[model samples]
Target chain A: MSNAAIPVTEYSTPQRGWYKRNEIAITPWLFLAPGVFFFLVYVIFPIFQSFNLSLYRWDGLGQAEFIGMANYQELVSDRAFEVSLWNNLKWLILYLLAIPAGLFIALFLNQTVTGIRLYKSLFFFPFVISQIVVGLVFTWFYDPTFGLLNVMLGWVGLGPINVLGDPSIVTYGIIAAGLWPQTAYCMILYLTGLNAVDPEQIEAARLDGARGWRMLWYVIVPQLKPATFIAFVVTIIGALRSFDLISIMTNGGPFGTSRVLSFYMFEKALSEYGFRMGYGAAIAVVLFLIMLIFIAYFLWSMFQEERGR
Target chain B: MFPTPIEKTSRTWQITYQTFLPLALLLWLMPLLAVALFSIKPEADFVSGGYWSLPTYFAGLENYGRVFFQSDMPRYLLNSVLITIPTVIGCVILSSMTGFALGIYRFRSNIWIFFMFVAGNFVPFQILMVPVRDLTLDLGLYNTKTGLVLFHIAFQTGFCTLFMRNFIRALPFALIEAARVEGIAEWRIFWYVVLPLMKPAMAALAVLIFTFIWNDYFWAVVLTQGAESQPVTAGITSFNAQYRAAYHLMSAGSIVAALPPVAMFFLMQKHFIAGLTLGAVK
Candidate 1:
């Protein structure tokens, strides 16, 4: 936060070289006003408002009642909340599968073959489309009748199955829809990373008879750490905030089996499930606190890198 | 280099690699290809049997015709364009100025403000949803494209500032000092000196912001209600609802809603990847 506070002292303090040199100065506030003002009202202020709203009960437009941590207490007992929380952990773990899937695709595409450029873009088409559309496509694919999945299953002499209608399979179905685009996203990231990988190190490894999985596990993976880190960050964030697919695919159904904290918060705060604003805010607060730990680490690492550069 | 580029392999293996490349790509893109095929299937085909096999009769025009003529797609597309273009422009300008001020000026708050913007960018949208929607309603900006644009620009500024500031900080400070030594006004230094150096950052951010805003579903739900101001994502939902039995039309609508970003990816593929993979190389 001190980084934001620095503009004032660095500009307004009397001892600066530029301050002494310029004949007259515009108000320092004039320079800082627009960005800071927007930050305060739109970004900064709403955060506190969310925190405050978590202390009360209000249904968007209704009268409010102060409940303090009562909303938080309700979260502890809500079975649906527990289910969503557990599913979110599954999402976080399963989503990392995209990182390696992406790396493998990236490595495959990194070859110097003809038509590889077209192949790369074709593989990337999923990431370009919005998740809502992806969900809709997957929903149709997963439809029990006249759908691709069932059609494929019929070939294997299996009965038609309702993937989205079964509670046990719904979260994985949605995650699979999500991974369609996510794996593409990670693939694109790693493709770029692989493009810039040092050739000398690989040549040295090759001379030592390193090849296949041995070379990949030892040399290539270490060089792709930054890409992996970024892929992990984005995948985790995408998984935790896995709402669009849930909303579009099944509305957290087969009995809210696909809900994550994001969709659950929306359902609690602003949907037909009844607007329990305080309770919703508490759910959001938990998600925020969890995300903060990752963000803090990301920023700390970024700062260290910045100082190094 | 990592896997031994396919060029140096044996001739037989090279032929195998070349043949397998397209096959792998086709398999990887099979789902999307299915969507494209489903989008063009005739109504009778869907009713007659499964969504497999090539359509006996093409209905691309008919399916697409129904999607546009029967749905609120035009209004939704308009809303997305209106909301996204200004946001791209507004965020680029605001972050450029903020980035300039932070990078060029060595003030006490420089690093702190930079990080605040970065940190704020990471906060979950849920935390901001209730308050932001309420704030929009209170300001009488709810259900309006302008309102959504304002919120997007404000939120996008955080990430853009981090990008813009880092890019600016990487430039030579001596250029600004040289301008200052010539008694150029400080603001002039920003306009004439730094702004020209900003085209690369601006280009990268533009394609990125366009895609992000185009795909935005969360804020679309919160800030805007009806088709008049709802984006393509929201457009997709109502299309999904009304065309419940019309799989062909729904598939067509999905394809249409997806075109702009897909087109953008193809056109700006280089810069798009450059922007997304920016900080991942260190």
Candidate 2:
């Protein structure tokens, strides 16, 4: 509004000509320059640097010796790496239960009940708090002696269970803790999706005697594809990126049973374990590849939408 | 609607749902409620092995006082505020500019550039872990709050830009077109014509980024160490390691560390949810 007061022909002819000639070509870059510079330096450059570091032998401070494929070969036989990879697979598969669980909660809460708004916000409480706090809360909850889980199990005449201590069930336990917050995230997404579901189609389905599971399956599910897609992508990313919980809860303890690639990479690179920068970078590259598979699909779908627009 | 409203169902079913609602909520929030309870209990209560029982005496003030006065929690909290405020400001500023450019302009590489930002936002921090740390060390910024803030601002810009660009795209295009016809400088148009319209986006992004950077634990551990620079998230973990079996103190520290973001979430609930659900909605 302020700029509208300036007359169009008031500027000097040469300056006006230059502004007209080069402004379109130069201005956008000027706007994008700071953002693109920082993003490239911090995000884009590091991806390649990490990939290149994976092919070397460097302990972060020492001379970088080019040892091609040696780190990769070492990773192929590393037992801890194998366990971490397997645990990551388990997290990916089991974390998916959040979708159905979230949809169930969303369907239940999608009504005009009084105080439902407060209930919805309270349900989202888990996602707002730090995962470190969640990890601590669950660690205490899973305490073997006098812990809530054991106390509850005692009601059923079952023995106390060491949730984080037993190597076999440790990963599952951590994943369950992760699912608490993740399920809330998905529920909010579905609630948004449910709000936008077409009422005409639902009314038609109701008239056709589509009810219960059939109504939800045939009528509601199709309309929620966008929400489902976002939920799946985020869950996969969240599962693969599982680090804070493991670090805070167990530190990949009980013989490294719960180590996902993210935590294992940090452990190798910077923890008490001597810094093998090359080897840790190798672990990160592997994790990156796993993520890139899904990221590629996500980007492709997004590209299709951009083109559709 | 899909489940059939409880009011239309039999009275027994309606009563059952009403009864079941609170029970299910209790089960869902059991862990958090337990922690909230533990935060108030005196240390003697834990020693008695009555973990599930009501606290023998409340020690909320004592525990919280010890955390603030005796521990390094105050310094860690100050560090979080210092780190989070700058990152939020930096990211929102940078992304708004980038968002304005990408959102309002017709360019050849727009979609590709936009995809780069989108894709970068999803990549695991592990891939950037080694190089970022190395870069920080070389710059003599390792163990400094500034280093962490810089990294966060740069990384968060990707997501913020995606959000801001989409937001600007949804704004009325005619405003920019009119400004251009009036012979306004392109930057002037952005400053005068478009930026004022971005106040809501700015607010939403600020709250969301504040929560994200405050709740960040991985980078705090990766970039900074100890009480000198670590945020409250990492500080609480180390505090736990120091206290060992002192669950009461740990619970107090955890609650303190978790409060800022939780408060931010409640205060800006609408904007936070809008920012998160932006792409998920049609």
Candidate 3:
């Protein structure tokens, strides 16, 4: 009995010692291992792979051949790429309108009244539903024959204009549809920011005889910087990621005028155009580079904040 | 407060603001309202071009019945449920663990690892498309619900971890320190102490992830195909293609596809907003 008890006690003590010695160092890795593995395999690794793939030539089914910047050279002269890039620029510019529009709406609704909570949510309804639904809704609304837009135009003795079919205006039409939901998102962010604004600052500004736009521009807007920054980041990201709506509404119709980088990449990679995997990868790389500029800024800012803390 | 409250303004201004509120909402929601109206209208109305006019008769029953029974919608919805529930559970579990590790510990690589997740979350999906699809194919998971669920869980972990880590950071560290002082095992402290406190954060992440996965159309199209595995978003798009002029049926399908997320949003409004506006306030 004494011998058996001694062994048990000895074994237990070392096991405890082992755990105690490495607990802080070992425990976190235990928690993080699965997540880090998945992220590296799926996200981080793919980024480098995509960049490497951009230098090769392949049809997705055949053996990939290293072409050493041939696809990138071709991209320089590709008319379709030009159109898509220009359209993306248009989308980026026009989509920024949502920030100011959202702020306007948020200010209008930032009141103390009965049923205001319900009103705020109702205004946010567009964002809750799927982009596919938004696409369909806007398509019907923009229909030349029986669309609400045309009906409203008829009241003004105006257009039965085919918005989607007109290449010159198609991107604008899609961006407008995109703005409906995006504006609501921005509005919510600003509303939250507005909630946290110091009442004393506003009172101080009021005592100094500030009012209206000046008051908003100087006092309120400065306080809303965090909201504005987030809105700006998300809006820029959303603009770059304009795929679903374009796919659903137009499919890059009217001679491929409304194509953005995202949709164009998909078309090259996997649509009826036949799979040009290498070329598609190159296109994706270009888009990634553009995004990297913003992401770098974002990360730098975040890092500064982290260090500050 | 910045704009000055409507009640504190003149009577005329208050009256005008009240009048303008509903009108603006109606205009903003007109497209959705139109779709809802179209879903209940009979086929004859679209044929007669009475799109704006009041429906001659309400055919809500027939349209919804046709969508549920005659189409591939039910299968698609089931696929969505299969894909989304697993994704939500996996993301929550993975993120919670990662978040706890990042939030509680002060390792040399903590901030770098955290930044990796934040940056990865914002990368355009196209960059991941070819590789992710190829990986799924290699694993024999192509065109499968499991495949979609796996990718979604991994991708969403980036955002979820960011959210959860920040949330846990905000939690009082004293509780955890006390648990350690009492000689609780590390894992047990996580389970018995921290896990229960993470309920609100978990609920918030669950709602946000549910909406994101449910409303996903791009990845659904890229990863899955046909009625067998495609979620409702992709399925409904194909449905629209097949029934080219069947506006009533198409509208009904869209509504059916959109209902779950809408219901989820209304049910978890506070959590949803809280999850979305994580860093905006401060």
Candidate 4:
């Protein structure tokens, strides 16, 4: 209304060109401000805050007492923390088995059989559901007396083993559940990669008498690198942040045996067990540092690709 | 084709492959199959000698009913819907605007801001747990559904913006130039000129975020405390506690909770896959 009331000549005569350039320049920032503001407040700033908080000792509500590297020092000596760290290592190592498993499934389903597409979607079903649901499904599957695994085992006269109840096998059992969805995820990625695979190259390789593993190794594997890279990246992240399944399945128990760093951090910070915010932040920092390695690699690849463009 | 196709292989190998396909699938999905059967089986089968047997009677309705009435399953469902819907809408809207700005503009900070969102998207949520929870408390939004929705929207904007920006960047720039030539305002260029062309991207993002945020257990747990505000994931934790021996009910609950995303994936599988593999392969 005010702009309409004022004449265009009054507003646009003298400084219009300078104003227009500045206006053009500021437009992007204007568009960016809200998102950037929220990101800074919620995502970016919290990262540094958590990092700083890692150096202090505070149970969330109290005044934080600066404790330098004390939290890190205690982390070095914390046995349960060590167990969780080892379990995380176990998760990282074992979770990777899904990639090959996925490829195997993808290969099996990639054929142009009748109903193959439906089968593929059904195969990918696990990846669709939330991990919490996966955890529950597996929890029932591993139930000792009446759980599916034990019941199936009993057919061969095997005893019902309390899978989640036993500390030794618990992490494996949960990781197995995790692998269900993860493997499906990898299979989908590989399936898409397979769809895009060059037919001529395959024919050329096959004509050379390259069969079985040789064809896969010399031809297919090289072409699938990008898919494999992405699958590997997501799998690693999934394995590391594997808190949902762990939390749901066992609460990192039968005695914290199944605890990954992400779960352990939450358990430390929020659960009734204790609200050690600083300690939780310290665990988070450790997790962040570890994840940063992968993040850097991904970013470097992305940057390289951008530059190549 | 890479393995020389199964057709040209030996008949024995072909038969073996055919037989092995079902066997491998059976073994692979054994756990899920068990849950599927348990989801329908009466409590008697689990109570009796075998959990592995064919269910004597289908109690699908019974099991599902118990999950609903015997627990706060209904509330949890409602909560999941509430949290997921807004987060999807909010993240999409915010990202669209941001994506448009970053993708279309050639400013120096555009790339920087893009990277920032991309980097932030991948960080473990645990690092955000404490401060986010604290901030929620400070804002008096703790233990509220709104609190979770707000945080989820903010956190997910990082990812959504990255996806949206990349997607928008791939769009032809001539549209924007044409819009400018038409003297359409910046915001209208976005709403009228750009957004209609962005339907696929928006759909792709909606499905992706719906699944991501729906499956989100960590924030749901961190932000909401009681049954009133808690999501299905957290609700399931408590539900499992009360229904300790009710495997039948639990199985049904799991299915019900899992249904939306499963259905979403089936219905929008193409878009979901497109979104997930957006920057992955090429």
Candidate 5:
């Protein structure tokens, strides 16, 4: 009886401590601590650090000099920066073509023939491989002397048109290579979305005389709104983050005509030429602000969804 | 059903589609097919500039042998495995917890925290490049696979959290409520109750993160260098440089580098698609 009383007293004393009383409120904080800490240290804080670093002139090793607005002013006169900005604009506009192209392919392949699954997977093959490999394959395909493109062109009675070598069309060539994998990605998204598509609506629309383009536009496409939204989000992100293909294919070559803001920032900060940390940070800031618009839209939409729930 | 299914179409159209299917697929995969052909061709074929013709003799064995035995491809591949596997495991573990906290709990800052992850995930790698590199260097993890793995986990946690939170939200809340009614501890409920239910999400996330971390080139370049720590994506660049004009060897190397992710996709095609299109279907 005395031993039982002693054990019960020891347990009772600490059982009602603050933690026990506030378990529900504090448990989440405990669960969230490590993830929040890691995210803050890595992803969230670096954004502001990059912003602050843009205002200072640092070569990565030497003492950073306070050079507020100088970096931004230099950006105004930099020719390479101008070229990079224009290339980025081109990327943004051209990269969006993946959506419609993807929809077309999805529509084409959404059938149940023998071995169609294999065909669908094969069609989606490009998206699965690394972009580096894609870049390399496309590079060879565009080679002037012995490329298949030239080989085909020869068959059509056209001489070799050096696609990658010609500065005028270099960006377009890279964009086309990029479109291959991107279109595959959007196609998969649409395929999944099409599975969830309401078949009854299609029947109703068909009975009401909607066919082909009209049916796809008025009935099918609306059912794919969720897919379309996801496709838009990912495609925009992919467009802006097009570093691998550019780096691999052209290396911002043909008189630096293919340099996008991302590659240019890397070149400025870390490459062999020199380290202009502040300038690179400035370029990144511009790119970030551009992406900010899309991020804001996505978050807002998601927030609306959350509140609706 | 949307395209009126090929079976329901006219005979000529059906016949055309049957023929057209292989033709379109061939066109779609032309570049890859070319690379595949290149990988199997002899050096003599490349020298003769007969790239389109059948290989003079199949050198697939020799070229792939050279890539496997005569180069640093193996080392780079090993590093990729080391880096990618750890990153996938770390992200899955970290995000699952964060997802649970956000999904099941009622907290004032929940939406804001969730938004932070979503927004961070979308930010360009360039924005995080300089500072992340700096942070890695400060920790004395420069040019190390651990450095790359740590960064990938932290960064990937953003996307994984978004995925897991949404997935968890879709799960019925009655299970959690019942567990709570039985006087289970929250962490116990997470481990025993929610974790069991999260198997599908965990599987989906595992395959997705594997592909993503495996295909990563930017961070691989930024965080590590040389064959000792570099993944195959970056290693392929150096491999090409070494065999600058050797199209057969380069093609073989590229195919070797690209094979793993392709295999992963085919093996986990369902989960991969589910993970990628988490929100695309209502």
Candidate 6:
């Protein structure tokens, strides 16, 4: 309104360039240019491209035919897809156990003792280590032939159970290995959350005889919402992205029972068998759709918070 | 404090808690302890089925020596270093600028732009896998550390921007406003006023990205094939394939691969946790 009221040629200084005149707005775009360009090229465009690619039949090296809905149609009849989807559901549900397990560990480790800092760091060791190493360590730990698990099973006079080789229990075994690090991640989040817990509230609750799980449920848990939310987000993403472990431990085997969507997509698209680019993109689309649900919820939550602020 | 601190607890319980702490830690770290034990054991022990027993002789030097000197582990480790460092530097530079823009300015598309980065960060990597690979291949960057680094920088910019923006938002706005009033250039305000204050955030992000990129097995496998370009996480699998059934050598290799990030965490423990739990507090 002010700029319209006063002529720019008469009011504005001639020495200032257009960039200086609109520095505030132009600077932001200038700053955002590289990051936005990179993100759009690599992350954003690829997403839409994946969605489009899923509708075609492409071998990745040859011509891509527009075969709309055929990939989805094949997915309906595909047993491997069924197993992968079911395993994804299993991963999503079971991976949430990390939150509670992490809370439990954090509560246990919350006390200040001599060398507690060292103890805390040591407890967080699994999370810091790469999942590949975790996979390898757990692979050896669960090894049937002279594995520590079988060794302990023998201590209890139980027969050796081949965890990775057994198709029925293979997914569960991988999930367990995944849980080890995930639990540590959650524990650390909760530990940090625990630190910022309002001491006065706790004291007041204590004065009212609120102790043990009662105080935790009503007071502590409410304060830990931020941590719980983060834990939930990371755990869900980690579960859905359970590729490296599967790739390392089982290679989607014992008849491909443990193939989650991410791993299965890689297998279909790029693995030695053949390049089913469209099929892989279709699998990836399904995974993305599943993720979109949670993404929407998260964005909505953040939006609400942003509006509140 | 929530558990009614052990200091106020019964004497016997305190004693029990003290003893239990170490025991719990031992049990929690049992698998890693097993690996550490394996890494130090002689090859003869594994052949004789002495997996659970104490080592007959210390071969820590020998096993790690083989990993460091005998295998393609060093090349893979160097590749990881090359890939990880450049990605971290690029993310830090790019996100700080984006973060500065999103944080300080109030624009019409601000919130939506912020959400885009957040949403993209949370998207499944598989969604971007095919195109990114094709793009990398087309660019003649396939089987190169530069490709991995480039993709990592781009992809990681999402989370880094989120973190950096929030960090910037928490800073005193008056400083930037003051700089502007004093006729400081906008970039000068960012460089002189904001970037100095963002050191802690950058430190936090550096360590976090270091760990993340170093442990990135998916992209390493997806983009690069051989030891020449693959990071240690992907390399460790091939390392295992080379020394199949040689648990000692594999354990040594695994330990070596996982060590850099672990060391980064411990050394930068405060910053790492701060970066990780950025949103967990508020």
Which candidate's TM-score is highest?
6
Kindly report the root-mean-square deviation of model 4 from the true structure over all alpha carbons: 4.4
Candidate 5: clashing pairs of residues: none
Candidate 3: tens digits of C-alpha lDDT, residues A1-309: 111111122224554676665676678889999998889899999999999999999888889999999999999999999999999899889999999999999998999889899999999999999999999999999999889999999999996999999998999999999999999999999999999999999999999999999999999999999899999999999999999999999999889999999999999998999898889999999999989998999999888876776
Clash count list over all predictions: 14, 0, 0, 0, 0, 0
Indicate the docking level reached by candidate 4: medium
Worst 10 residues of 5 chain A by lDDT: A1-10
Q: For residues B57-96, what per-residue lDDT tens digits would candidate 3 score against the true structure? A: 8899999999999999999999999999999999999999
Per-residue lDDT tens digits of candidate 2, residues B91-188? Answer: 99999999988887777787788888999999999999999998999999999999999999999999999999999988878787788777778889
Q: Report how far residue A9 has shifted in candidate 1, in Å.
A: 16
Give the C-alpha lDDT of model 6: 0.93
**Would you list the rank order by DockQ, best first?**
6, 2, 5, 1, 3, 4
- Indicate the docking level reached by candidate 3: medium
> For residues A1-309, could you state the per-residue lDDT of candidate 1 as single tens digits?
122212233344576566544422342345557877787789888888888989999887778899888888988999999999999888988888999999989988888776778888889888888989889889988989877888889999999999999999889888988998999999988988887789999999989999899999999899999999889888878887788999999998878888999999999988888988888898999898889888899889888876776
Better of 3 and 4 by DockQ: 3
C-alpha lDDT values of all predictions: 0.85, 0.90, 0.91, 0.85, 0.91, 0.93
User: How should the candidates be ordered by TM-score, best one leading?
Assistant: 6, 5, 3, 2, 1, 4
Candidate 4 matches the true fold with a TM-score of 0.93
TM-score of chain B of 4: 0.94
For A118-213, candidate 4 gives per-residue lDDT tens digits of 778888888888898888888878877667788779889988899999998999999999999999999998888888889999888767888778
Global Cα RMSD, each model: 3.3, 3.0, 4.8, 4.4, 4.7, 2.5
lDDT of 2 by residue, A1-309 (tens): 122222344444764566566677667789999999999999999999999999999988879999999999999999999999999999999999999999999998887677788888888889999999999999999999867998999999999999999999999999999999999999999988898888888888989989988889889999999899999988999999899999999999998898999999999999999899999999999999999999999999888887777
Comparing 1 and 2 by TM-score, which wins? 2
DockQ each candidate and list the results: 0.57, 0.60, 0.57, 0.54, 0.59, 0.66
Q: Mind giving the per-residue lDDT tens digits that candidate 6 earns over B1-282?
A: 587788999999999999999999999999999999999999999999898799999999999999999889999999999999999999999999999999988778988999999999999999999999999999999999999999999999999999999999888787776777677788998998999999999999999999999999999989999877888998899988888799999999999999999999999999999999999998
Candidate 5 accuracy as lDDT = 0.91
For candidate 1, write residues B1-282 as lDDT tens digits: 767778888999888888888788777777778888988999898788756878988899988988788778877888888988999999898888888777666655667788889889888899998888988998999999988998999999998888888788878777876776576667787789999998888888998999999999999998888988899999889888887988888888888899998898889988888788886786
Off by over 4 Å in 6: A1-15
RMSD of 6: 2.5
Worst 10 residues of 6 chain A by lDDT: A1-10
